[model samples]
Target: MFREIPTVNRLLQKKWNDKDQQIHLQKLKNAKSTFNIKKRRSSSRRISKSTSKKDKIQEDRFKQIERDNKILLQKMRRIMKNHSGVNLPFEKGSLNKGMRKKQLADITLANYQLLQRLQDKKSNYNVLKWEKDRIDNKKLAQRIGIFSSTMVDPAHSKSKQALPTLKNPRESTTRMTKKRMKKNYQTELQPLEFPSSFPKRAKTTTRKRKRTIATPEEDGDKAKDLDLAKVCSIPEEREVIFQASKNDGKKYEVEISQTEDKMFIAAANKVKHSEHYLIELEKEKGEEILKEFNNNFQVILDNLKVISRRLVLLNPNINDPKRANTTRNRTRKKNFRKLNKRGNASQPSLRPGTVNSPSGDLMGVMPETARPVSPTQNTNDLQA
Candidate 1:
């Protein structure tokens, strides 16, 4: 019985050992399953957290993009409104509609490109302008077809036409007086001795009567009747002039002379008239003289008058005391001193010389000696 009981106990121990081992294995499986589930949950939590942060960042970026777009749109709207009146060359229909976002962006990019191109064009335009200016300056210097004040032709600038000559010539009047004389008689009455063949002739006597001379008026009328035009067909004198001058009241005599170069005044002596009668004639002659004078002479006379007036105005002495006082206050004077000359103070100096003294104290002197030459035995030195 005791041995049997011992075997049963061994069996029971083995059974217990198997059951405990089973339990241990089951616990290890359960723990492994729990660990796997915990690891999966932690991984899911981390992924969800990362996803939430990414969503928030995307929302902020979207809001920022919208704000930037609104600002840019406002600026574009202002630009569009200000420049609405300006139309594109070929897009007249597009003027009534607002530009699309893509179109606005495209326009902005195009504007940027256009600005760059414009800047480049402006620089090139400036360069071209400078080059053109240089070319124009060169043309001006070369006296090309360009018309500039500094490059005017010398011939065109100077006047080539001469002034006209005086139309009227000046002249004068003259007068003459008549005179008569008588002579004494001493007659031999016999013919001057002429040698003949020795023949004597008796003296003969005859009665004679004096003839009366014709009056000046009758002779003048006769001369008038003569054909003077036919008789003097040719010009017999170098110069001929006919003039008349008044002597007494309403009395004038005509004169013909050959001194045409003496002008109208050549008849001045011919006009032996009263003062009142001569006054009228002198006035007429004076006007004719002025009419015949040279233009250059008139200009010279005008300039002389102006210069004389200026000299009178600038004279040191003034007729008015107020002007003299003003002049004295405005005038300035410089201090000057006379130099003390060494000798010949009264004599004027023609030139500076060692023996002569200077004209004024302004003179200065310097000591100078002849060039020194060494004595040589050669004849060339003596010649020098």
Candidate 2:
């Protein structure tokens, strides 16, 4: 048994020689062999302190990572909501280590890319509108003889100070989109309505056509009235009767002679026997042919039935792009084509000899008799 602290205190108070101190203070590898309790407990306490410090360091690092992640997510949400008017949530805690880092990096990259795209589109629209307004202003300036070339103002002042600077430069895209919650998704949706004073477009009507059948002329068919002799070079003779064979188109002639009548009678008797033999042969072969056809008739019927059943059972592809009958994909392609048409879209050309007012509404065209104001024109006459 190990002695208590009071025994160790009494031992320490007694002065001992160097060899006796060393023997008593010696440590052993085996726990049962060790006699000094304080030495063993002290060594264990040192090891425990090192392990605890390491665990504390690791725990602190994990907590720091968690805190930073929360802040990052908050900033991303704020940015998305401000720019796109959509508040999106990021998936957290579901990933760890490499997967977690990858998720956050992807989210940040996506956010920046989406932000850039939205801002660029908005800036591009603003730039196009600005260019259109500038062009319209130039045309108006030229019409009133206050163009940059003339360096004249509305008051017809010759001084440079009278003319407003035409260079209203545009701001950068970053500065433009820097505002938070700019879209402000609180506005109510409204249907568009044209003002009552707007002119109505002309309505086009389609005309329907009636189908009529043709009737024969009252003068009778033209083919029956025409003489065949006038159209063809072949001669029509009355001495010998001529008939054409329906099968071969060969012309047969009969002459009123005794030898010809005898030949015709003998030919008719031979033809009757040959015709009777041919009819009997056909009847003999017909039965064999019918038997052969009957063997495969059921098989042909079964194949037709199988094909019909497969067609009825097969499902039709509704949204497949490979199918030519897919109307959804076809309509999607049409919408893409419609969106592609925007490149050529521009504001309508200004009316000739006219200018838009300060309010952006187009002013009425000038009278034909009224000529353009020259640089030398008086200001009072223009005002009137």
lDDT of 2 by residue, 169-222 (tens): 584446445443244211112213435674556676686657543333333344
The local lDDT score (0 to 100) that residue 352 gets in candidate 1 is 14
Worst 10 residues of 1 by lDDT: 305-314
Q: Find the 10 residues in a row with the least total lDDT in model 2.
A: 263-272
- Once fitted onto the true fold, the runs of candidate 2 whose alpha carbons sit more than 4 angstroms away are 1-126, 146-148, 153-384
Tens-place lDDT per residue, model 1, 64-163, is 9999999999989998888866665874556535557678889899999999988756232556467767767766765433333323445434233557
Number of the top-ranking candidate, with TM-score as the measure: 1
Error of 2 at 147 (Å): 8.7
Please list the C-alpha lDDT of all candidates, in the order they appear.
0.38, 0.38
Error of model 2, residue 47, in angstroms: 36
For candidate 2, what is the total of clashing residue pairs? 0
